[model samples]
Target chain A: MGKVKIKKKSTFIDMTAMSDVTVLLLTFFMLTSTFLQKEPTIVYTPSSVSEEKVPVSNLVTILISSADKGKVPEGKDATEAEGKIFISFSGGMDSTQVAPVIRGKMLDEALKVYNAQAKDSKKIALTDAQKKVFQETNMLGTSFEYLPELLSKSLTEIDKEQGDMYNPNTGIPIDGNKDKNGHLNDFQIWCRAIYTVSKELHDNMATDMGLTVDEAKTLGDLYNAITKDGTGIAIKADKDTPFTTVETVFDNLQTMSLNKFSLMTALTSEEEAAPAKH
Target chain B: MAEVQEHDSGKKKKGAQKKMTIRVDFTPMVDMNMLLITFFMLCTTMIKSQTLQLTLPTNEKVQKEQQNQAKKSEALTLILDTEYTDNNLPKTDEATGKTVHNVYWFAGLPDTTFQTNLLAKESFMGDTKENGVKVQQGIRKILREQNKDVMTNYDELKAQWKNREISKETFDSLAKKNAADSTLTRPVVIIKPGPNTTYEALINALDEMQINQIARYSIQLPTHTDTLLLENYQQRTGETVIRPTVRKSVVY
Candidate 1:
């Protein structure tokens, strides 16, 4: 028999097509995926049955906190024995304390903006002739020190306890006398702070930018112009804070301007188990 | 002759000799594949799994219904104040002298001066009467008044329905119309029981509202902002915030 040989065929596949498709899918997802920014930690929220949906356009955030133990009623007794703290104003105490705090925080933010502007203008010293113009303007001389002191005093007053003298002749704490007035005092301080901050910022901007305070006021006016159609103030209180405090903040904000405002609440995945009562 | 033949043979041999080779360019193919992948990737929508955010009402709807009568007369405002007491002892119905027979009914009734006065009388009776006849009578009276219009409308529609003269759409509309009109007259009951108010108490109120056929109801609670402020106050002062234990109605 004659000798014979058989040839074998080799099989191969190109993976480049599959790799290209996978890469395309990966790129698409990467581009389209939304990454949410980490939101602030929220400790509490006041409850309401209002179904009114607040718009996101106009918002001024207010932070609120309660007074210390000495400020609340029955604090000394409750603390010593049962480790309990009782607010003097019942459901409304927290609100009273927060009104002033918002005012203070707003002032602080305004002052920070003013200081930043002042420092930037100072970097390029004015010419001898320009210095006279600047001196006449006195824009650089504005001070924010007054704001901090005022805020501190307001905070102190809010933290003060109701006095025996303020108690009614019947020896029971009067509902409308010192305690009620005290609550309003915080609100007044907030209003005053807004006035002060807005005034200061407007004046300084006018002097620095060589515009009138009225022109400087345009900054707030512009902000209002943009956010005016919707609710004005946006308050975000810690979750653990009392509902009274947040209410007070809202009340103060409402009084500041007729413009509508909203309260922001942080939503969480885990349900808040009701607080354990004594 | 031999030279010419040899030369011709050499030329023929030279002409027969040749070299063959095959080649393919891969650059354009790679580029095209990449471009196709990019286009597909750009057009495709990525699947996203998201957690639905929800705000659950903390106030008990039935309880709110039992507390204030003014809510029915005007725009109802429900304020829920929940307190957790260690004892878990059910709250005494300060209005009724007798112990609550049905938790649902107790929770659903409006917390009004009338209800309170009735309860006070029942409590005074001190088991002198069998069952809560007076309380049942008071509830029935209010329910009848609230539902009078709707009940009448329902009867008219039902009669029309029996006649087989009305279209399906008209019948449905009539039924819905009757339901909505009746619902409006009925006050939204708000229960602002302290946390110590037992689950049994809350459930009883719910049952009562359901039995009374009160459909439009909402459980109220402090706003999110209020809760946050409370937390902040506690942290800053290291003090416990004491909320009011009283349940009162304000006419706004």
Candidate 2:
């Protein structure tokens, strides 16, 4: 009988389990990760030792940079090179000088709503005299025609003055034109962007469970709910900010009834006994 | 050889060869992964969401003191115009003795006269010819007077506070204390810069004030609200009232 030769057999391993694990990790990250919504507008915040956490919801961020001293030396943009940042009030723009900006916007929006509702309900065209009488009698009939006109004219004058004061190309008017919504277009755009980013993340999370936009409210509500229930908002400001600006910002926040906010700072490895004086 | 072959055949035939199988226990790996995820979740600091809220001071009629009572709390009015110098000092022409600087004091009113008069009073202990010398003397004198007045008022107010009189004297003392405390707390320098005064000038004034321990001060803004009736009465009657009643007045 012919002697049979023994041949070595090589083992072939399957990678199906490893592939499944990799896919699971990818899905996990896709489901859990959060995306940043807005490009951070540079704001100067004063340093603080307080460990209060700033809430993440309904946050109207105000950028308070040091005020620009004067015209920059040749070959430099004033905003870029000059270390001047004013205490900007969110929604109001300039809280110190033009506080009426926010009130004006709110009034304008309310007016538009009233106008739309009145046109639908009354279905009657009235003379100027009749309109005046209606305005006096109606509960929601406070006239906004004069206020809107006045605001528009004043804004135009302000734009003209600002144009004359600074280089037109460099200094943009905070209020350029009212949008169809009767709100400042820039502010509206900012709000829209924030809403979109937050909504997108929230929707993505809900998508796996087959949730719709109407069903899944934006993330802002969650943040608001959490914050409104006594959770504080945390703010992290850069060290170069002036104490006055910080105080002004703090005061403004207090005035707005956001007293539960806290300043964010770098956590030291060990808690120091006392804060260091400048 | 025949017996050995038989034995080998019998052994081979005893059982059919079985296929080798491998099994992996994923329980330990899953446990480690879960532990890692829990650790990360525990270590991460959660950030809170917040918004700013503010209540602006209303355009109410805050009472202004009577002229005679105003004497107790001297108003160091500094008018800042657009042409304020880098040091926040009004620019003065030595040759012409004119202020080329423009200010918003009274809608671009030339403040040279006011500054010159104020500086002279603040710095001069004795008559001086040099402008700089006079300015220095005037400032020194004004500061000394302010300190003396503050100390005296504080003492008087302390007595009245103990007695609960709450007189105009007490108010004046309180204002002075507030101003002094503000100066100490924040670096504010009061400069009457012209209406066209540059931001740099304002900052310079603030810096100067900070250096001189006068950091907490405020630039006086013109009163836009309706004048207080009490203030008007104080001015007319020359009487000091501790508390004024709040009443609405007809605009007409």
Query: Which numbered prediction scores highest in TM-score against the true structure?
Result: 1
Docking class of 1: incorrect
List the global CA lDDT of all models.
0.34, 0.34
In the range B49-93, model 2's lDDT, one tens digit per residue, is 222221223223336662122221333433432222344332444
Give lDDT for model 1.
Answer: 0.34
Q: After superposition, which runs of candidate 1 have C-alpha atoms over 4 Å from their true positions?
A: A1-58, A63-232, A237-241, A257-259, A265-278, B1-79, B85-252
Interface Cα RMSD, each model: 17.7, 17.6
- Cα-based TM-score, every candidate: 0.31, 0.27
Ten-residue stretch with the least lDDT total in model 2 chain B? B243-252
Summarize candidate 1's per-residue lDDT along A1-278 as a digit string, tens digits: 87676767634334455555666665666677544211212123332222234332222333332212233355232112110111110011233323333333443444444454445543222234432332221011112322232223332231231121122110111121122113323233333344454344345546867976456545532133213432334443332233333333333333444234344432221111111111
lDDT of 2 by residue, A23-117 (tens): 56655644564433221223333222233345433333433333333555577443342122111112212233132333233333434444554
